[model samples]
Target chain A: MNELALKELLYKIADDQLILGHRNSEWTGFGPLLEEDIAFSSMAQDKVGQSYAIYQMLNQLGEQEPDTVAFMRNANQFHNCQLVELPNGEYDFSLIRHFLYDTAEITRFDFLANSSYEPLAQLARKIKGELKYHTLHANTWIKKLGNATEESIGRLQGSLNKALPYALGIFEPSPLEQEIIASGFFAGEEVLKKQWMEKVELLLSQTQLNLPDWKTIQPVLGGRVGQHTEHLQPLLDEMSEVFRIDPSAEW
Target chain B: MKFSKAEIFTLLEDVKDPEIPVLSLVDLGVITKVDIDGEAVHVEMTPTFVGCPALDFMKNEVLEKLKENGITQASVSISFKEPWSSDKISEKGKAALKQFGLAPPMPAHLFTDIEVMEHVPCPRCEGTDTELKNPFGPTLCRSIHYCHTCKEAFEQFKPVS
Candidate 1:
């Protein structure tokens, strides 16, 4: 294994999950409905927990402890795709983002479930089970609301169009992309992006939403190499608000 | 006799799930193996999910329960080798869940079928005329459902695949 390549891959995956999990948790008491509140929080816990497990794996490879790594990292040290770091602007935007990002993540986990790396494969297998419902939840809501009413459909369509460019950033090719692909670690972001497009296209076709010619969309990249939006640092600061207060205290 | 495997196994019944106190770990099928050597005990378990938050608390409870049984030297190990599925929840656990106002989990295979929600029996009235409030619930392993018959809402322990 190209160890550096592996580390890079892991960092991006873990960071993406951690950041998005935080965003999802923000809807705990603020969802449009009670069930949605619970659902967002449930998925939030799963995503955060998934990130924690990945961080533990990184620790085994000589990274710092999970708390230190998660709470203390600066914006430049992180490697998550920018799609997950954006604010949950509204229910429509948040839902659209969830639908897009999870479509790609589920595809990634499916490939990882069969990975040559035993530990990652094991973790992937378990995570794949959890993600089945998540994607299912996203799909059901998209189908229900995408064609429901003028307002709902219009809102979703608007957010979907707005999020598409940033969603494309999820496929930003890493420096070790080729090596990671060659080493049998993963199929690379290229394959994942292709699979995601097909899945998203199929799902959107069932609703009133219209997907623009994806090729025409300009992908907003750079989050993978640690360049982030102005939104990320504030989120990080808020996440570490309590942790930084008593780093050494056993809670 | 100092502690024996069967005795330790029986003693483990005292450990209850923190989230659902009505069911014991044994009843939940979380306890997979139990071995004993004199006063020392080794117990093996599997959590409902790989990243389940309750894993640590469950293990500590098992250890604590063992000590309460006068067995101090105990080790509780976890593995996803035999990943937990909802089918493992015992009949007693199911009954306990229903009586506690929560529906027992459907089989793991059913969750993928979408039909699992179409007929979730209400724990409140045992009514089949139920509506899915959300397929997601407060916990990772639960989902909310509403019963039209009794005008009540309940949670179902979702099957962990």
Candidate 2:
């Protein structure tokens, strides 16, 4: 059990959930429909809550408290894939991003449920069930709108094309990837990416969406290594604004 | 005053869920364990949903109830040691939820598909001709549904395996 490998793995997972959870929350009042609004907000709560739980695991391993870690981090410190931090452009883009990202997320956690790390395995077991609804929501809309109108199909296709490269970034190999895998902490990102591709392909096949040649797209990497887009800092600033004002204030 | 583990559980029966007041924490199946060590009581609980906002309130309520019963040296800890599933909700809790106008979840073992959410029996009319409007609801642990028979919307405490 390499502690550093475990922490690195935990940090990336937690950061991904936290950032995307914040993005999902942006749809709270702005969903195209009332149910969609509540749906995104609910998933946001689930994701953020899941991140907090993982952060607690890190804390048990000697990391800072969850609030301080979440609020105090600069954009460069975040390990979330750039795909998640990208602005939710339109209903089509947001929905497509949700579809692409959650496909990988559910698969990742499913593998993680069997992690050699017991604490992580237990947490992943719990999280795996909650993610079902997130995937269900994403799949439902992708099928419905993906087959609905010409405009709907075109818009989704455009977003899908735009998001795939960044979505591929989700599996950017950790520096300790082999150690993490050999230690049984995880099965590694390569295995996860293969399964993710399969799942994504299956879902899109059920719709009118097109997936281009996988080999042609160069994955926009580095998010797992603390590299992120310009959008992240502003989002972090806004997210931690209230906390920075009074770090010790009880909410 | 030393209480036995069973006795501690009995005392916890009075601690109701803050959101669903009709349901006790014991009945809701969140009280995973209660141990008595000397004069101190240790209660281990798990949340129905990890992100449930009512978790802290429920934990405090359990502690407050123990103190109100004169057990001052008590502690409560939250964990996933015994992760909660919808199946853990006792029959009594299910009845209480129905009476409180919320449908209880079906057994998680019964279905692996999201379609299981469809056609749930309406808590109001006990009619199976219901529709799953949305899988997400007002709370993390619930889902919104509509009863065609009753012509009204309701929420179900969703099943999570």
Candidate 3:
């Protein structure tokens, strides 16, 4: 296996979970409803915890400790797609984003469950089962809000349109995509993207939301190669503030 | 200085889940394996959830239990080698969970459809008429449900396949 390619794959996966987990945590007290609040907070714990497990795998492969890797990185050092870092605009946008992003994630982890890499495959298999609830939560809300009142439908549709481009960024190909696929470390992003699109389409078809032409929507890329939007640095700064203040402090 | 695998498991049975104190790690099925290596004992375990905060505490408790049992040279490792599922929970653990006012998870085979979560039997009233309030709950391993019969909300130890 190409060690660099493997690390890159792991880093991107871990970063996505960490960043989105932080965003989910932002919903801790602010969800539109009490259940939604607890739901997001719970998912936040799951995602952040999942990210920590992945980082531990990275550390075994010669990266920094999980805390250092998670808390010390600048925006440019992160490998998360831009989709996750965008501020939770509203309940509508957050729900749409969650639905789209989690669909891809569950699909990705499902593929990774069969990865040629033994350790990752094992972890992925376990993580895959846990993510069922996450997708269930996302799918339920998307369908409910997507087919409800005029305001609810309009808001969800608008957010879905706004989020699609960045959601597409999730599949930005790595330079070593072929190598990773060939080595059986992963099935590669393109395969994941295709499967993800099908699943997304299937779910949205059940709702009142519309899917726009794929060719017309440009994917907002660059997050894979460390280029991120202005929103990312501020998130990182806030996320790591407590850790940076006392790196040596025991929790 | 040496202990049998069964003896080590017996000691570990005293170490209950920090969150659900009524259930032992053995009954909960997190204690995947116990190996006796001459004078040193090594145990393998897996967490119910990837992000369960109680794992470290569980590991420490295992160590402490072994030490109190006079098996000082013992070690515990958390791994995904034998990944956990709700099905792994022993019948005894399920009863204990219910006794503790938390519903045990449905069998993994019956949990393929997420709809099963919507009508979990209430631990408090054993009422089948229940509604899933949320799939996520106070802890990573639980889900919230409301029982129409008892007019109370309860949690279930969520089933993870």
Candidate 4:
């Protein structure tokens, strides 16, 4: 791929991480419990750190400065998944969202860890280590909520029902998907989706919750293509407020 | 192509934990083995905690630092055997912790008998009167405690895994 195309791909990854990190940060100090609050915040910090690395790479590649790419972009220009754009509704909903995202991300990072692109491969290796902790955190909650009181199980099931469609949106392909796959930057989307489903299914089997039938669920579009839900605008507004004030200011 | 072992040990010491920046794995007492065979250097490390985020960062930093110091073929092997513990911290590391405002680990022998004593003496205040608040602190490695004498809340690093 050309430099422009590569830069766009990098931005897509960075933007996804930035938006998700921002969304997750909203839960700081407000999580269901103290341990969870710290865990969520830690995960949010990791996402922001990952975004920083990608943004730095983009700047080095001469595409645009990190601030310009992160804060100056329009909502429609962001390439994060639609699921990450959705606001954290309830604790159960947030857990559901986390479970789905972490499962997919684990598979994604595993493939990226071996990318032919040296920098990406290195970042992926670092990210994969952190991602393992995230997966464990999500899995702990899933199992706890799944086996807890009937009320907790009911609430968790409701969250899964509501969020699963949007969770599927995370797999939406970019235009450079073929090149990325061919270059060994990532495994094929189909394979990734399958792996994600299998992992999710395995976890679900341990709980009382049932996996939603794939055929019945309609996939939400956008996110990967820069289209976003209504919730993204306010999030972008808050995140970019500082950068928008003085674009030239050193962060 | 011959190099002294002491030179390579210094290179390994230069690579600090990325998250904790101030503590090298050696200082943290997480480095389990360092072997030099011909031109290749191999370093083994155990995590301070089972799921530390700094593991990969430390590994990469070790490789880069070794290469920069003219050891081109350095290998980092992670081991879980002989898991790291606070007792493994060198005397110098304990002094560094006290200097850095973190409470150093109490002598391992003290922990067994002081099960009921909720507060250890504040390393800063030298006061035996203190209270334990939250077991979890800002980071997984710390626990929140308050010093009654100094009227300050501080994070104390927990025992290493």
Q: Count the backbone clashes (under 3 Å) in each candidate.
A: 0, 0, 0, 0
How accurate locally is residue B96 in candidate 3, as Cα lDDT from 0 to 100? 99
Q: How close is candidate 3 to the true structure, as a TM-score?
A: 0.98
lDDT of 1 at A174: 88
Better of 2 and 4 by lDDT: 2
TM-score of chain B alone in model 1: 0.92
Q: Candidate 4, A175: how far from true, in Å?
A: 1.4
lDDT of 2 by residue, A1-251 (tens): 69999999999999999999999999999999999999999999999999999999999999999999999999999999999999999999999999999999999999998999998998888888888889988998999999999999999999999999999999999999999999999999999999999999999999998999999999999899889999999999999999999999888
Model 1: how far residue A239 lies from native, Å: 0.6
Q: Can you write out model 3's per-residue Cα lDDT over A1-251, one digit (the tens) per residue?
A: 68998999999999999999999999998989999999999999999999999999999999999999999989989999999999999999989999999999999999999998899999999999999889998998888888899999998989999999999999999878888898899998989999999999999999988999889999999999999999999999999999999998999
B-chain TM-score, candidate 2: 0.96
Please give the distance, in angstroms, between residue B80's alpha carbon in candidate 3 and its true position after superposition: 0.4
The positional error of residue A62 in candidate 2, measured at the CA in angstroms, is 0.6
| Candidate with best DockQ | 3
lDDT of 3 at A87: 95
Q: TM-score of every model?
A: 0.93, 0.98, 0.98, 0.69
The residue pairs found clashing in candidate 4 are: none
lDDT of 2 at B120: 89
Candidate 4 docks at the CAPRI level of incorrect
Candidates, ranked, lDDT: 2, 3, 1, 4
Candidate 3 C-alpha RMSD relative to the actual structure: 1.0
Pairs that collide in candidate 3 are: none
